[model samples]
Target chain A: MHAIKTLSLSILLGCFSLPALAEDPADADPWEGFNRAVFSFNDTLDRYALKPAAKSYKAITPDIIETGVSNFFGNLSDVGSMLNNVLQLKGGAAGQDFGRIMFNSTVGLGGIIDVATPMGLPEHNEDFGQTLGYWGMETGPYLVLPLLGPSNIRDGLGLIPDSMVDPVAEVDPIRTRNQLYGLRIIDTRAGLLAAEELLTGDRYTAMRDAYLQRREFLVNDGKVASFDQDQF
Target chain B: MKKSIIALAVAGALTAPMVAQADATLYGSLRIKAQKLEGTSHDNLNVTDNSSRIGIKGSSELFNGATAFFQFEQAVSTDTGAWNGGRLGNLGVKGDFGTAIFGRIWTPYYSFTGAPTDILDNATSASSTYVINAHRASDVIAYVSPDMGGLTLAAAVLPTDKGAADDETLDIKHVAANYAMGGFTAGVSYLGFPAADVDVMSAALSYTAGDFYVATRYENRDAGVNGPTEEDAYEVAGSYTMGNTTLLANFINDDDNVDDVISVEVQQKLGKQARAFAAIIDSNVADGGDGFEVGYRVDF
Candidate 1:
């Protein structure tokens, strides 16, 4: 019994003394303090303002109308996606995006319905950020934009060029354009309501890490270092 | 018409950029198994659901680096097409200090001790002696300390509502400590049923080296004022992975019950979120029998 006790003590001590895994990369978030403050501000605004508004919008809208609104915005975004795919030299993806725009706009009643997907013309979410990443630009420091949430130096810069070609931004008459932007924002947030349950751990950290990992996944077209789908 | 419209809406949401939002995450696993059992009078082939479940979890920053979180999980019966089994529902807060959750929860005793050797996706848990303790329970309040070096401590209490039993407010209590470093982990746990004056002690050790993993557990239950005096159980399990394929084996013995179980399995990974597996199990009890099973699991 004494010898058994001694063995157990030794094993316990060994377990405690074993080395730990390496720490997270320090350079990933050089501006963590500022970024955290911005994240908090954005989170507060989302909780108090945007989320409630989106919830109300979803509550009032019919499912068909909601889907139509989302599809319309999606159809418009395909134009920019096609441009970005061409810029990144992905001919197949560019063609598919072009096909989606034409099919959805014509047969689908000005994009109010999405006939392209059922017709095997899948949506490709190409953007200027992904184009830059495909051309070998490194994602710099993580940043949390006010009200916009997680981003990085490269993607943030890419967003400027992306906005220039945004169909909503190009809409004539300031009032109509602003209304379209507001509707799009509410629809997007409402669409995310069902997905919110996937978040885990620290809200800020989970969002940041997911954003970074997803960006890498997109830029490499799903060729990620690790693909553990069981992780939540 | 409504269903088609809803389906389209779902498709649109699924194609959206998934990682930009700060909200709860929804995830699930679906597993179904086909099996054949032998050495039993009514031995037959059966298709069964294997603990498939879906869950939603979220956390919100509270104050001073602390955050509040909640999770709700429910089992889905794939074979029967039913979805009414509740697995977990808990709310908690955590920070540098620790985590405290109250609701239905997996017992610390099971997590620290039984989990090491409860590796088989199915059949093994029911055939093994680790069924001595309740794996999960409602009305549980659990606490887990933040990691100190490689050591972590956890505790839980199950309280009975007034007038529910013989006035024992504290129905069951559990305490556990675990140490994890690199690829090695060790744990010890103690559980007590105050009303019955029964107690259990268990220990587990596990190691992972690259593609190989092994674990062992020992448990002793003192069934005071209950039955069978004392029961002791032990189990050992091991697994090896090569590329997308993994092989696993486990053996369990209950000294008091004179029961023994042996199980082996081979699993093949399909992409990132899906797997197919085949298993064989044999147990030496009156109704216990040999069985073969094939299953598929996918998670999202």
Candidate 2:
């Protein structure tokens, strides 16, 4: 019975990814030129501005304080994660995610400390882009937004509706909200500092391929059949 | 070519029903753990992503009665949304005689050194202290012989870094063999890094009957290229399952470390693809050194 429920849930969730299922998406980049151009722009901005700012932030901020800032943002994202889990009909996971928010908020000292994980309630990551892909929607075309970097037509469009559900969208005073948004972006980039060294080859192509692969992984909820093989 | 095509057509017609059902698959597990450690050297509480990983794999029958397979698995951190790294990214072909593969995959020695006893999900686990995890190799080729009466042999070779700017050496090799009969199984692996001082040899033995199972592992690292340092470790572990619950315990002894741990874990099935677990570890080297964690694994 439990197996049946899990299978049905996967099937329902799998519906969104069926359109492009057999299409052999090994070379899914149709907008390569435009994407590369935008990617260059994003890269320039990162090299000139964002990366430096992040470095400065890293140098000035103490490690514990930086972790707290990350935890705060993480706690905020849990609201969106809970909503997506509920939408996917994962009631148990949704409940746990909700518990994460409550515990991290109160006992964790307003999300500065993560007190929920040791309690056996784990974090569930979800987003509107993944939700759309869960509904059997085609990933559409590859895209690179001006500042957001790698994305796709479906996920790029998802940002609009997702904002409607974001708690930060409801914050008063546009300046304060903008400042929070800036901090979130910087914090996220800072977290990726070590991983940047792993990137190899053409920056545009590398980022594009990684984004597509990651999106597919998310859409399938980390279940995908191997389609390519290498031999000695 | 025409004759081969005809034969393939005949074979395809014969297996069309099964062929139609063949498909690739993607699967992974997400595990997040919250842990508290109290020791003379450390006292803190934190949440961690405990080896959360995602992977895709599949195999297809070829016309020549061989199967071609591939898999790509990578680690993802749930707490901080980081890409930890890649694992088991390889492709291979299998047939009646044996199987051959290339690309990054688990070293044959890993099964002997870590697979049996590294049951707990985090650094507090015995593996951190007991296992020397040279568990993966890149740009290598490997082969596994067909099982003969419950016995199998495997070997892998990593080539030299000729393209590297440095005068790096190569010819690293790993070999392993395992035999299983009835309620008992045993395996040993030798990893030779002739150019470097990090050669490791390990072995594991296990037995299971009914709902109870136990295993032991040992590993020795030779001193050479890096420094005049040699290290060795041993571990013993056991587990029992009752209904949907499992109880586990493991102890590690290391020659180089001043701290060692003995841990006990309780894991409960939450669903077909989910589990909740709690573990506690006691330290033998430090005064007031102990660690506790509760965690969950959600597989999809």
Choose the strongest candidate by TM-score: 1
Off by over 4 Å in 2: A1-232, B1-22, B39-42, B126-131, B160-169, B225-227, B284-289
lDDT, residue B78, model 2:
89
Mind sharing the TM-score for model 2?
0.50
Writing each residue's lDDT as its tens digit, candidate 1 over B58-122 gives 98888687999988999999987789589999999999889998998777777777787776675
Candidate 1, residue A83: lDDT: 97
Task: Give each candidate's fraction of reference contacts reproduced.
Answer: 0.00, 0.00
**Cα distance off (Å), candidate 2, residue B125:** 3.8
lDDT of candidate model 1 versus the reference? 0.75
Model 1: CA > 4 A from native = A1-232, B1-22, B39-42, B125-130, B160-164, B224-226, B255-258, B286-288
lDDT for each residue of candidate 2 in A1-232, tens digit (9 for 90 to 100):
1111112233234323333333553457778788888878978988998779888899899999999998987888789888988888766666666657755765577688987676566777677778888887787887778776677788877777667777776778998888888887777777666556656667665555555665676667678646443311
- Clashes, model 2: 14
Docking class of 2: incorrect
TM-score of each: 0.51, 0.50
Candidate with maximal DockQ: 2
